[model samples]
Target: MSTLPVLNNADMYHHYSDVQFRDGCSVIHEMLKPKRGESILDLGCGTGRLTMQLASLVGDSGRVVGVDPDSCRIAVANEQLKKMDDIPVTFQLGSIREALPLGPFDGIFSNYVFHWFERAERAEMMHQMYDSLKPGGRLTFVLETNQPQPNAIIRDIFRLTEPNLDEESASGMKMDVPSVWLQHCSDAGFLVELSEVFRTEKAGPNLDAILQFLKASIPNFQPIKLTDDGLHELDSRYKTGNGDEVAFSLTVLKVLARKPQES
Candidate 1:
């Protein structure tokens, strides 16, 4: 699909991501390597599942804040935090479209959030992230990229149904090339020490599960408006390559950029 993946709305996403997002991002903890007493930011922290994990890792002396544009997501995250007796994390209903926390943080992390913006906005987001970090602070994230297999079966279904879905309309969802981000990091004064793409495949009981995951986790991944039957038909069409099982793969690009300590 040309559009970035996203849940139809925050609430629908809240329902699915509350359980799945944490498990899906299990790899990020090791990637983040959050240290005790360090200040970290979870950009686009959905429902605080990983936020709580980050909070625990930071220990009593550490600090972390989760930011998202959706108020409902922030609210849900806040509610989840309340269940805990103590946490070092906070949630804000904000976005990278605007400013971020004023900090020179030890690290900043985003899971599936960067692709939501266009290239220019992404550059702005990068500068803000670079400015928010400490001299040697790091920024790392996992986002979908159009590479090796920009397999967007969802968009194909949309095209088959709406023959007139032009490129302008389809372009709303992005499968950005990796070089775009690498350049953004450079423009934002970050030294990109690591960059790589990891391919993940998913096949499950049915298309419904995968559909919900895509709609929930991806940002603007699907176009608005479609009947239930239409979605089911789309799902069936996707399985043509895999028989009864629904199989698909997504390319996740992991980037680690560090602000120069001297600068």
Candidate 2:
């Protein structure tokens, strides 16, 4: 796979996580239900915020391993680890496609991460997660749903400025609906525990932040750089009102699946 769009922009991503994705932690915490003395893996753990949180739940006897594909993010994660001397959390630079050899974990926790996997690789990812877990290990996560409204809004806004941009190439992210995810889990030998779809809103980014996110996180949008005047125009057109924060709506999918014990 080509390099991730956020590979070199860890600081911006850390900021994005804090402001936009932090609120999802409550749902993740409730779903994962990590136990003390349990081994957990934080897959796609960008900058290790959630990983540290998991470590706290697991306590001194347990350990949490955080893995991500981006080196810069991993570096940031390691830096954060310095302040977490009591938490048994470690960050590794790796991709999910590797089927991570560090395994037999009691639980796996990911937040807004699975959708980053390519659609074609998702089944394999499910299998890998299954293999990485001990029997009855749980995989819990929340990610953007495969609903079209969000993507459509992005495409529509970009098209206003660049009419030539194609729909298929506008986004690098691959989100899927719950049914599709359930099928993958079943195929990988997981017993589905819970699946829910929900909606949430985040403060819409301004043009400067939007441009940074697109350039740093959206591969398809990277090549289509917006001019200064065009960006200002799009911001004027899309932003809600003067001095008001724009509302960005997202449909989210939450799942808790477990590897079935040997019969």
Candidate 3:
């Protein structure tokens, strides 16, 4: 396990249990199209939502290894999979920057996880993925694009609270645009197969739902200290637009690459 302390792993998993999957995972699933009996690595497999789905596709003959930095999340994932009798699935607690236990996998799948690494470290992580995979192994990852919704009131509040926050601090990591990410993959010796950007709108049924979503999705926002008046103002603004139907946009970049046949 990594020595680095993870912040509120159990809270994170519990908060995101009902969170909806963006289009990025769907793109990865389409690109991967995991065949029976193929080995897969689900890097940063949070609560095993997508990991479980991948396991189903891989079936009993195939192997699925789900790894996360948070031990609590790993525990939750293991608990979730414990009831299943036939699927060949294993869960590990680790970060992508560290050495992985098993490797040369047939496919690597990640969703909404890579943006957590610093830009300087991202290339090395990609190289690590390259090293962990067999020649011609596929790598699919989904990352957030740094585009906020236009005329977004909630975002305005977030900006007001933390205007000078660094990208790494605000996001709990760094993120790059699609082009830069693709370049990083190419530099890591992966043959770029597919890359694209897509946007999605998330709707919270009520102010509480929106706040819960924010607390789960954005780590920096979780530990925020808001005064009573500030909280009231935020709630009032969120309730103004659509009677508690708060809508926010997310921009995501999806990439699918393959390790070189010789590397």
TM-score, per-candidate, Cα-based: 0.81, 0.85, 0.85
Predicted structure with the largest lDDT when compared to the true one: 2
Q: Cα RMSD (Å) per model?
A: 4.3, 3.0, 3.1
lDDT of candidates 1 onward, in order: 0.69, 0.72, 0.71
Tell me how far the alpha carbon of residue 254 in candidate 1 is from the true structure, in angstroms, after superposition.
Answer: 0.6
Ranking by TM-score: 2, 3, 1
Instruction: Give the winner by TM-score: 1 or 2.
Output: 2
> What's the TM for model 1?
0.81
lDDT string, candidate 1, 108-186, tens digits: 8887777766654666678888888889898888877777555555455456445576532543555578888899899
**Model 3 worst lDDT run, 10 consecutive residues:** 1-10
Instruction: Provide the lDDT at 29 for model 3.
Output: 64
Candidate ordering by lDDT (highest first): 2, 3, 1
